[model samples]
Target: MAQVASLFTLFTHHAKTFRDLVYSLRNSLLKTGVFTNEKVAEQQVVSVINFDIHLRRDADGHRYIERITECVPVEQEAGYPETFRHKTTTEEKMTAFMETMLEYFRRSTDRPLYVARNVIEYRDGSYVAVHPLSERSRKEIAACLAGPDQAAFEAFLAVHWGDSDEN
Candidate 1:
């Protein structure tokens, strides 16, 4: 049960980090006009992904492949009217948006919360659907961010979830 709790906690941390990363990217684009002003203010940027993990051994021992994906709308049309200033602006904006998002996603990889979900499970129907993060969990995670005690935090989660399981 403790093991399960630790896994759950670690997964929760990563989930939040990923969520924040998307928000950061979205804000960057919105502030710079990559997305329409109204769309950026009124519409939320939604993210969904199917992730997997595996255990294998090689000359360098085991490794992990983690992928984080976000869904954003784009125009697929190729050619446009030569005199269409709006279309030209849109295309340039799209290029800038993609570049910004890619850079943000890359930086997310260095975050411990994102990189340390090695023990998590992302299978369908495996979620418990609780609030994204509890107050205590959020506080602990923030502290970890400041000083980096991820392993200790993982252990704390193990105890927390273990108690819940026994009940």
Candidate 2:
């Protein structure tokens, strides 16, 4: 593979899971006065950290990658599909606002702020891709690819993701 050099930052952490790493970073941002709101701090962490590369050492004293998790940012959609700007009545506006707030509350109750899942894992003494990149992630990658590399990347997506047309 050809190398494209850029800023490559690596550090060792004892986090057992991707969520733990994200939580730690979020708390760090808050305690350092970078962000006051917990939610904002969490979102910032999630967006910034795209991947978590974990490692493990075997009994033989050989260290290898355990898993590579991809941090998928949760799409922050508006609470309600309808906009309250056109609503003239006070009762109607109040109802719309309450409905939006209820949706947000339900989302927090049901799902996490963001998702982190392993895209690659080491099994049977070999590295393997366990999950495919999400559509959003695929698009982001495609956008970053140059025209010369686009065809090859599309072929890779087809083989790996079983997708070709959209990307």
lDDT of candidate 2 over 1-167, digit per residue (tens):
01135333466678888888988988988999969988888887776676789988999999999998888887787446465666889999888878777877887766467778787799998877667777777777778889878778878766765653431
Clash totals in order: 0, 0
Score every model by TM-score.
Answer: 0.21, 0.72
RMSD, each candidate, Å? 17.9, 5.5
- Candidate 1's C-alpha runs over 4 A off are 1-16, 34-44, 47-62, 65-167
Instruction: Indicate which candidate wins on lDDT.
Output: 2
- Tell me the tens digit of each residue's lDDT in model 1 across 1-167: 22233422112222345445445645755887767653333233331211223322346764433332222222223343233333358777677667666656654444221211222433342422221233344454556554457656656655544334211
* Cα lDDT for residue 126, candidate 2: 83
Alpha-carbon error at 58 in model 2, in Å? 1.4
Estimate candidate 1's alpha-carbon lDDT, on a 0 to 1 scale.
0.39
lDDT by candidate, in order shown = 0.39, 0.76
